[model samples]
Target: MSKSATIYRMVMDGHICPWGLKSLHVLRSNGFAVDDRWLATRSETDAFKEQHGVTTTPQVFIDGQRIGGHDDLLRYLGKPVRDPEALTYAPVVAIFAMAAFMALAAHWVVAGTLFSVLAAEWFIAFSMCLLALQKLRDVESFATQFLGYDLLAQRWVPYARLYPWLEGLAGVLMIAGALHWLSVPVALFIGSIGAVSVFYAVYIQKRELKCACVGGNSNVPLGFVSLTENLMMIAMALWMVAKPQLL
Candidate 1:
């Protein structure tokens, strides 16, 4: 068996190929000797592709057998594939994680302590603020997508546009520990509406649609995760209303 590999990759002065560099790195890291062949011009690159009958760049050959391109090389080495289009809960997880950390930090700064019921309140409030900010980044797009599932947004078109700002205001007020009368009712109303809408859309209607939660472009499904988000808001609202003693 041959222990050597040759890579045909584009490497012009102004345009260095990323996959070519990756291929070289992978080969070297795996203790394989590499014959570096640079297609330095468009004509040379075209000719190389034509000769190999492959459509893409950074072609690798090991022991005179075609081992294919960058992704193929990773597969050959038994590495995990990182598909860009793969759906994940990573974004929501990251957002909540950051919100929790921020809540703890804020609590520590204000009260000179860590982790209390107030800290939990702050966490939810911060999460709401962050989520609202994400939606507000492109409110028009968010409103357009939200109309697909949100019952209120469907009837009152202006509600979709106003929703993010309302969420943000309620969150900010909660963080300030002020205007409970306004914030509590706002949170309860919105959260209740959101929960019912999500339930009806996912369970009753059985619609397979992307959630406008997080952002308009998010791939998050309109289901349990979304319902949980709304439920959290409702719980927070109720907690605020019932816990005047805690305050």
Candidate 2:
């Protein structure tokens, strides 16, 4: 077999190891065969350790040369490391699209049809919230596996819960406003809350913190996309505040 075709051994300790699992998946995705026999056994680990003087699991060896961990393997595979700046435009586009869609829907559709739009918005917001919560959970799992710590995991649950609930409430308020029973103030309130959340995400990203907005899927640093999203939400709030009749 060719060198690249040779089955490589990856030694991993726990199933919860993100780096190991990610590396294994990436390797396999890149067409490298990984030998799972080296996962979490003293005998397998000891043999590799004696040969390479490595004490940790997630050891990668190719033709008997130690290749270190995930980062190293990623480098070896020549995959472009994630760059936050590169992803800035995507959020901006998404926000603009959302704003345009909502505006068109509100304008073209009468008040009677608003309920259907509100329902769609409710489902979307709920879905986004669920995705965010799931991402937060994955982040917790990742932190625990890598750092042997669960501090963020404990704190994230409560803080994260508020977002979905607020989003769902906003959807409800939109529906109520559409029914002409509630004033524009309710829709404004909901939009304001969303704007605040997006702005805060922007602030966090500006400070170089990773955004947990969409959860683990968000690799892009919060910047223009977040800011734009916030501004759009605020604009929507203002529109709703100004025109309760449209709702």
Candidate 3:
């Protein structure tokens, strides 16, 4: 036998309760025949709330038992609740994903081919620019968080402030394919410093800290992702230095 559920929600001109619609959809999708009841006016909604002893719309009932609102329905349906404050790799993943996609697009436009060493160069360059932009968004916050584990930043506070600008400059120069003399040195120096700092902070000291790689306000952890980002910079710097001789 198909189960049945009652969903009471607001449905007026220019004022449809979205949660109520979602509740009805969930019930229907879950093999339940939904008894959709609409509160068509302010008084109707108010009276419905008062009569049901509830304060909100989009209330659901299963087997004559109240299932509350959207969140309550989710809980009853066994869905995981996502907390906004939770730590995640989403920021770093987005940075790398977008950088790689942009690099490929640039490569295809300029060279007319997806296969080239320049693609890798562009990827690293775009990654640096994007990452630096995140940091530059809130330099003070980034520097404060960076100083917690970065050896150079802790020793010389001003370096923390300068790091994002330096990175941004290097990225721009690399992207423009100009002034390798300046950009290579900057990339090499900062990449080396970052690699050493991340290594000691994560491996040796074994401290669990937030990574300022994306920005000071980010929730990325100080671990493999941070390490890989620095390594990529170092490799790019080395390639830029050697590309002339190789050609």
Candidate 4:
């Protein structure tokens, strides 16, 4: 005899609640025989909400005890609840992972090979452009956060504002394999400053702060990941200058 659960979710001709679907999936995956109840129309959904005193749909009941929505269900099952505002490295990790994947794919598409020295170059360039785009979404916010610890940004406020654009442009040019004259110098300059600033702030001053690497509204902590971005740019810039001659 499997455990029995009842779920009330919205399902209409024109619209379906995604959370409702997720709840149903979770219930089934947990080995529950679910009595899936549907609120087929807005009026019915409203009526259900009024009757149950819940503002949202996909309410679950297990063994006659009411469990709230998705988050509530997770809690009931002793699972970790999702917290969007918590400090996390998820954004940077995702960007780096995707950039590496795309770099390999791009190299394969262009050069008819799955692996190459060039893929590493593309990975850094792609990561830089993506990270810059995140900062570009709210330049003012990013600048304010950046000014907290960047040595050059502390002395010159305008550099904080201009950093994202420089990074983006350099990354774009590097990806295109054009304007080595411009991109190489830009990457080297910013990367050098950023590396030094991060090193001093984190290692020397030993200050803990939020990184503006992801964006202005980012919750990522400043440390190894932030330093890695600058180090990658410096190495990439040096490679751009040297690879041409060595190849």
> lDDT values of the candidates?
0.90, 0.49, 0.92, 0.93
Query: How high is the lDDT of residue 157 in model 1?
Result: 97
Q: Write the per-residue lDDT of candidate 2 for residues 123-152, one digit (tens) a residue.
A: 343333343344445664323321211122
lDDT of 4: 0.93
Best by lDDT: 4
Segments of candidate 1 deviating more than 4 angstroms: 1-48, 83-85
Model 4 — which ten-residue stretch has the worst lDDT?
77-86
Model 4 per-residue lDDT tens digits across residues 1-247: 8899999999999999999999899889999999999999999999999998989988999999999898899889888897987889999999999999999999999999978888998999999999999999999999999999888999989999999999999999999999899999999999999989888889899998889999897899888899999999999999988887998
Off by over 4 Å in 3: 1-64, 68-71
Model 1, residue pairs in steric clash: none
Encode model 3's per-residue lDDT on 1-247: one tens digit a residue.
Answer: 9899998999999989888888888888889998899999999999998999999988999999998998898899998666666778999999999999999999999999986899989999999999999999999999999999888889999999999999999999999999999999999999999999999999999998889999986778899999999999899999988899999
The superposed Cα distance between candidate 1 and the true structure at residue 165, in angstroms, equals: 2.5
Candidate 4 — number of clashing residue pairs? 0
- Model 1 TM-score is 0.80
Question: What is the lDDT ranking, best to worst?
Answer: 4, 3, 1, 2
Question: Model 4: runs farther than 4 Å from truth?
Answer: 10-16, 39-50, 53-56, 244-247
What TM-score against the true fold does each predicted structure earn?
0.80, 0.49, 0.78, 0.85
- Candidate 1 contains a number of clashing pairs equal to 0
Q: Pick the candidate with the highest TM-score.
A: 4
